[model samples]
Target: MVTQDELNEKGKAAVMDFDGDVVAEIAEECISAGLDPIDLIQNGFTAGINEVGTQFEQGSLFLPHIIAASEAMSAGVEVLTPVLENLSAQAEDKGTVAIGTIEGDIHTIGKDIVATMLKVAGFNVIDLGRDVPIADFVEVVKEKKPAIVGSSALMTTTMVLQLQVEEQLKEAGVRDTVKTMVGGAPVTQDWANRIGADIYAENASDAVVKCKAAFE
Candidate 1:
């Protein structure tokens, strides 16, 4: 059996190589070896991406490298997600969150970071991706009934779409079903409150903590 450390190391190497297929192969091996999929994601994929994040923030790594690392981590998730989902059925959720970037905001970096951190923190993150339609957000909430809904915006012009989402949720009759969280580069805690968002996160870790607290 391959040790968890070895699998993580291989996954990390795959990220450094920026080879998606290689990352998937390594993740599959970890799964076949009976390692916990979440552990593989954490010790392997997320660990590598977190380093990418650090390097990116420090200006030691370029945007391309950060993109590559995210691609690699996403590839690993493709291989391991089914296994993790099976376990999730039996595991207690730290919380479930429906997350997306608002319409007209094509940015995903901030939302992706929050999703990754939430997953690492044991939350079931249903990421709706960038430029999501308002109906999609409401539909997902109706289906998943998550503990929280998170919307992110990068551009100031697109920030109002978050409010649109809130209104849509109200019209759909599930506005009170879940707490709302909003964040992005230009978003501040006061702005979140002003827009009726239940909370705001300056970064991914903060988002994860806020999500955990919302359910507690």
Candidate 2:
């Protein structure tokens, strides 16, 4: 029998190499070995992405590398999603959240990671994709009406779009009804408070913790 640590290392390597097929392959192996899906996500895929994140911040990894790793992590998570849904039936859905990068910001790797972590943590995630307009967020809040809305912006220029989103959400009259979460490299807790955001996530793992706290 393969040890959990060994499986985790495989998962990590797959993401580091940006090999989506290998990531899925490791996920299948974990399933065959009866390992928990969440554990695999954390120890295997998330662990790898976390390293990729560090390397990215330190300049050892480039944007394309980060994107590839995120893609690999996403593929592994897709493989685990069904099994997680089954687990969710045994547990309870935390809440619904809509996530996206703000308008004019094409960066998405971090946002994608947060979405995956949220999903594994039992949240129903509605990903709005990258470079999403503020109006779309307001419209989604008016239409989909998720419990929370999250925005990501990688640049100081684009980060203000998160503030704009909050303003629009308030204008739409759903501000009081929904919680707004903000995150990205340029985002900070003070910034979140200044922007009237309900939550500020530092990373993918922290995002899951904060999302759970919002409901709890």
Candidate 3:
């Protein structure tokens, strides 16, 4: 029988190698072991992705490595989604968050990372996908009534769409009901302040930390 520590190390290694098959295998093992999917993700897969993000930032790894590791991590998460859903039914929600990229922003890597990390952190996440229309985000906010609304844009051109979401929320009379968080390559805390967003997370780790802090 494989020990949990060994499994954790394997998970980390699989992610660093960008081996989706290996990740899925480990996920299956975890499920069979009756492991908590959230713990598996947080302590195992996320640990690896965090390192990948660090290495990428330090230029030890490139964009392809980041993308591959993300893919592997996502595949592993897919294997555990049902377990996560089952656990969700028995636990109190941390928070409900709606996330999306702006209509003109096709880049979704950063947004996807945040979504997965949020899910692992026990947030009820409604992912609106990349290039989502502002109307759709507002509509979901009005309908789902999540505690936080998150928007991302990798480019300066589409970053303004985050403002549009805020405006739409205000126009729809739901702005007061939810917190707004925005992030991306061109996003800064000052920009978030100027845009009237409630929070500005620098990266996925910061996103989770800020999200937890918002409620705590």
lDDT of 2: 0.87
Runs in model 3 deviating more than 4 A are 1-6, 54-62, 93-96, 104-124, 153-161, 171-173, 183-191, 200-216
lDDT of 1 at 39: 64
> Candidate 1: how many backbone clashes?
0
Q: Write the per-residue lDDT of candidate 3 for residues 101-131, one digit (tens) a residue.
A: 8899876767876887687678989999999
Q: Write the per-residue lDDT of candidate 2 for residues 29-110, one digit (tens) a residue.
A: 9888998777777778878887887888899889889778888888888888788777756656898999999999987767
Residues 1-216, model 1: lDDT tens digits: 788888888887788778999999997898778886666666677677767767777898987887787787788887876775566556566868989998887767568757866776678889999999889989999999998988998767888788888889999999999898898766888788777888888877678777778878
Better of 2 and 3 by TM-score: 2
Could you tell me every candidate's TM-score relative to the true structure?
A: 0.63, 0.83, 0.71
- Show how many residue pairs clash in every candidate, following the order shown: 0, 0, 0
Sort by TM-score, best first: what order? Answer: 2, 3, 1
Q: Of 2 and 3, which scores higher on lDDT?
A: 2
Model 2 clash pairs?
Answer: none
List ranges where model 1 is wrong by over 4 Å. 58-60, 91-96, 104-127, 133-147, 152-177, 182-196, 199-213
